[model samples]
Target: MQSGHNAMTGFVTVILALVIVIVGLVSRWPLWVWPFAAGVLSTGAAASLVRARRRRPLIPPERLLEPELPIPQVERWECVIKDVSLPSLSEDYDFQFSATVRWLPQEAPPNAPVVNAGGLAIDAVVDRARRITHQSPPHRSSLVQHRLNGELATMVADPSGRVLAMADNVRLTLADADRERLEKLATVRKNEEVWEHERKWEQSKRAYLGEDVLRTPGSAVVWWLAKNDEKIDKTVSDIGLLAELSSAANDQSVPDDFQRYVPGLAKEQEPLEAMADESTTGPPSPDEYARFLLRHSGLPDGDPRRALYLERVAEAAKGAGLPDVADALLRMLGDFPHPPQSAGPAEPPFDGYFDEDPPYDD
Candidate 1:
């Protein structure tokens, strides 16, 4: 408040000084005397206002108290029955016991139980029924609760009384809130497992299959030299032969024999060599031709071939521990590319069932 008053006093003093100067210059009527008097009065008023405001304490704005959020309440009941009053046990008693349970989906619908209590156990299905009703974990987070939720709603009763088996086989009917919380926990656990699997897959990506096969000709043969029943001979398979047939080294087009086998693919050797040799293509080519051989080499068409290929692939995979690389090559061979003419959108088959069928009347 004092600072505001001081500012107003200073503004007035400046205006008065300007007026006095103008009057003195135009009419020489003691304007300088007016400015001095105005300046002194304004200075005194501004200082007094500033001092008064400085002595007072500042007041803060008042705020309203916010309301508290409502809490959810659920009802629970527990009764202890200690009074034992009964008619004579010699007569058959028609005791009733029932239990209802549903953990997931469409469970058996709930029904009442008719219990017969003979002396002793009496194979108590009704008693079992009651046990079923009360079997789930009280905290309701255990596997026991989930298991019970998925069973038949049943009963067993011995007219002869049995102690409650409170430790197992019962579940609570979840109200909306509790069910939502439990299901959320299940979802979180599922996502964590998925994330863990995804991480393992990613970590295993770089050196996945075929890394060893890239080193030399018939390299899978060289890499798995240690662990073979007899030996995995690259000489036995046509991988080397196919490579030579398709090699960019061949000045001619792919041979007819190669065409007969792989059709659209020029024996795995041709376009592959062109793409593979990093030295020929550049410092870093797309992939090595040997890599294709490693992948496509292990998959034979028939039983004996498939058997042989699996043997080789297993050995190579173990030796190199590069399943990822082998996988890429295997995928390429299995998913051979098609020419535009043969690969265009397929035509839908035509059928005229209505013309050959009975009239529309029904």
Candidate 2:
């Protein structure tokens, strides 16, 4: 557009100068008037073009980047199957196991596992998390409370399925079939995650177009897509194998009520139900419960009172017959040492929101 304007102004300047010279020669006006007029007009046109050029954007407006959208939160269910013990009380049994689950109950934050405490931000987080359901990928939901040994232990799931709480010799007996079933479920879930990641990586390759793909005559482009495709295929193959194994172990369909983010994770609810039995002892104190909830939260970098509070909480858990919880607390006392005073009830565990820089060739 600037170039077009400059060309038109130059053409006009030439025509005006010619007219001025003709008119000056033909008219009774002084000859100096025409030269003066042409020079002034030329100077004015040059000045205008220079000003317009300075104002023009170097890159087209459409090509300039818009405000970057917040990184999309990929909902993911991070399940950790810590320990599998054998035998339900019955001769015939289904799979039962102890596991920790971290539900990203929402679209997930751009900087998840560490969201802002502001009111609007909190609302958005809650809204996202509430959309959680059984069929969603990247399952996000609430924490699971179960008994580790005799103690009531509340655990927020971590991505790496480590035993968040367990006594030295506390084993929940499960039948051989149950153990096999749980193992199969674990295999399926793990491979499913791998498959999803591989699929996303493959999709990211499509972002390149125009000269990016054509510049090198498809040398790097072919290899790049092929490599990702191979990864995708391998993951799919692994998932198929695991799924077949799972189907072989239990041909029966999972009941509708039994649906959970991670299959078999609903089994954790069994203990909670048992705890509710009138014969069972009482629940943990509010403070003990509160402390357990906080452990799952990503603590701030530093704070002074964390050590003292953790010591008190550990003592409370041990008193409540949850040595596993106490021990877990001891291990983590040094791990996320600082919890903000207003951190409140810990939010459900979520995938950490790092910027998505899919490793792909451009």
How high is each candidate's TM-score? 0.19, 0.17
Residue 53 deviation, candidate 1, in Å?
Answer: 99
Task: Quantify all predictions' global Cα lDDT against the true fold.
Answer: 0.43, 0.48
> What range of 10 consecutive residues in model 2 has the weakest lDDT sum?
137-146
The Cα error of candidate 2 at residue 256, in Å, is: 99
Q: How many angstroms is residue 187 displaced in model 1 relative to the true structure, after the best TM-score fit? A: 1.6
Q: Residues 1-362, candidate 1: write the lDDT tens digits.
A: 44676677668777877766676678766746765766776677667676766674464323434457576785322222221222111122211222321111112235634432221221232234335434343234344335433432322222433311121233333345545655787899999999999998865652442244323333533444434536546334444444344333333444434443333454444545565665675532223433455445644333345433443454455357566544544544453432234576864433323557856775
Runs in model 2 lying further than 4 Å from the true structure: 57-362
Residue runs of model 1 more than 4 Å from their true location after superposition: 1-130, 133-156, 159-172, 209-362
lDDT of 2 by residue, 1-362 (tens): 77788898889888987877777778867756766787798898889888888896778988877778587888543344434422232334422334333333324545556432232322332222223211221111112111232332333222322222222222233456555766797799999999999988776654442224422322333544555775765543333233333333344333223223224544444344444663774664433444544533344325556665676677777777777777767775776546445657844432333348545677
For candidate 2, the C-alpha RMSD (Å) to the true structure equals: 47.6
